[model samples]
Target: MNHHAPLSPAAELHANVSVPFERAFAMPKSVYTSPEFLALEQSHVFAQDWLCAGRAESLPDPGDYLTMEIAGEPVVVLRDRDGAIRAMSNVCRHRMSTLLQGRGKVRAITCPYHAWTYNLDGSLRGAPAMTLNEGFCKEALGLPAIRCAVWQGWIMVTLNPEAPAPAEALAEVTDLIAPFDMTGYRETFRESFRWATNWKVLAENFMESYHLPMCHAGTIGGASKLEEMVCPTGGAGFNYHWILKNDSVPLALAHPSNTTLEGDDRRKTWLLAIYPSLLITLTPGYFWYLSLTPDGPGHVQVLFGGGMSEDWLADPAAEAHLASVRALLDDVNVEDKGCTEKVYRGLCSGLAQPGPLSHLERPNFEFAQYLARRIPA
Candidate 1:
């Protein structure tokens, strides 16, 4: 079942559990700027969670693979000669070097360090400088491999030794979309942008809807009403759900309805930020999944992908919807970047105190709780 455990006593205590209408949160500035805390988070949060790395559809054929980084570990996902998708370290096990620099077809992963080669399935295929049988057994010298699994065309990966199997951990991300039958949808647009700010700042910014009226004023605010927007929270923390005004999508699309959407159409559009890093949006004409990857404490790369029918993939849809999404994103990003930098600087002013959280800011409160749980004790 898709669910979230209740907040712990300490978590509830740190963030006042009573207020239902306040926007203030008391997250420590250190969590945003401390060098020690960021390193601990890499092991506790990024390396341990089941993350959506890339789409399985992108690597559907044999020898096809994408060079990517999981948490901070360089890795590759490839369809082997036998047509099975496998996850393996993109680093050569012999001398510990990068195998592939970028995404492409490869009969074998050859290391630039010493010309060591590995099959996509991670078998030690060739080593020019060393003897095979006289040295390490090819069977025993395969590249290190990690577990990966696909659901609804999304490829999720993990580096944790004890992380639940991909299929089991992702059952929740899948069940949430069961009503939409996403297999029929195909990726139409994919774009990524690197921002000069902390990734957690972006996550905290996206976990709620309070900024829509102010930050998103030019785009979504220009086209619709935020006051009537219905946002409810779910997921591990307080993720959001809402239907906007004037959301007119085709009935044949993912959300099929003959009725035209007016003010506050509850089923018109759905926006959710899944725990940790995934941002998912389901609209009348399309659906998009975004992953927020932390390059370092002060840097992040936002990966965005759009989905639609075979027909829409060939052409664009209503300009207003796409424009609103992009503009709202830009506005929110600008607002968030300012705070991230401010917090990055503020943490140094000796105001780094653990403050209480208001319940209306439940998502941010839970975010602090999540960081607390993930950081090593």
Candidate 2:
């Protein structure tokens, strides 16, 4: 009688997903549905990786701050008086109350519960009524700092001190996209919302162009040509694909006055999925991104933002162009919401199984491998 021990779920997943691209299939249903898997990912992947916070330019002055949570730890990213971006614990040292609630300019991080104030640099500025306590030491009570770095204008933070800097990890991507001068693009707006779907479902949806003609038919679908997309093998820190745009959206192409990009490069769009969960759509004229965080096993929180490049912003009809782009993105997001939510629903069925991946889904396959490598056996 054969008495081979049963494989643990993580071990089985690792074995199944670590195959060559030609033999790859979609990830198992448990990857998106299992609470235990999600917890493992939170501790091992999200907490250890360099997560994109937002563009540094968004916090133009000292005291401008944004709050986000990483693997259940609240963090506040702010500009100090010295004009450097900093990330620190948003939990007040005293009583452990959350110090901030969203993004805005602030004079200091003040805990709403007890009003223990912290300076922009996260040093304790004041703790009312604490002077009598001999054990209290203000010098030793600053909010603990997290590792923070800026790469290609994006603010990245990691709780793990040993993670590679974003710029160092994404050096190849920088070289490939050098001509576009991504840092020259300025953000115009940003918003956050929750969607009722697994985070990876939305991430995979963004990684491939296979569903563009069907999922986004009413919006940006007309510009996507399955035959024109190029999906090369992915690198260690990222996956990418390219699509040549049609004339359907003028802003999706290079501006008339832009001389930096020439010929076919002007109409090409790069879809980049930076490992873990930062998805960027970079075009010659504009760029947009989605930063994802898992809210739970069944839901994802998204940070959506976009803007035009310096050249496009200087155009005589820039406002009209931006308005059109925003409108189209809104419609495309609605379509994606519907599609990803349905996928999650199907994965919940007892009979649901992963199918073989299409050639265009090369990026998705690479993403699965990334997850498999990060989550321990």
lDDT per residue, candidate 2, 1-377, as tens digits? 65797666577679878788899888888889889899999999999998999899999999999999999999999999999999999999999999888989998888999999999988999999998899999989999999999899999999999898888899989988898978999999899989999999999999999999999999888787888889998898999999999888898899888888888889999999998999999999889999999989899999999998999999989889999999899899999999999999999999998999999999998888888888877
TM-score (C-alpha, index-matched) for candidate 2: 0.97
- Residue 75's lDDT in candidate 1: 83
lDDT of 1: 0.64
- For every model in order, what is the number of clashing pairs? 0, 0
- Residues 1-377 of candidate 1 have per-residue lDDT tens digits of 63687544334434443343354456655555556667777777888876776666777689888767876799888888998777888888787888887678877888889888887778888888576457667788788988787756677777877876645655664565555545655665577787766777777666656666666664454544545555454555326655554533342243333234333343455666656787766654566777888877777888777665333344455444455555555565566666556655555577566454434345666666556666534
Single out the weakest 10-residue window by summed lDDT for candidate 1: 251-260
Highest TM-score against the true fold, candidate: 2
User: Lowest summed lDDT over 10 consecutive residues: which window, candidate 2?
Assistant: 1-10
Q: How many pairs in model 2 have backbone atoms within 3 A of each other, for residues 3 or more apart or on separate chains, i.e. clashes?
A: 0
**Candidate 2 residue spans exceeding 4 A from truth:** 1-7
State TM-scores per candidate. 0.78, 0.97
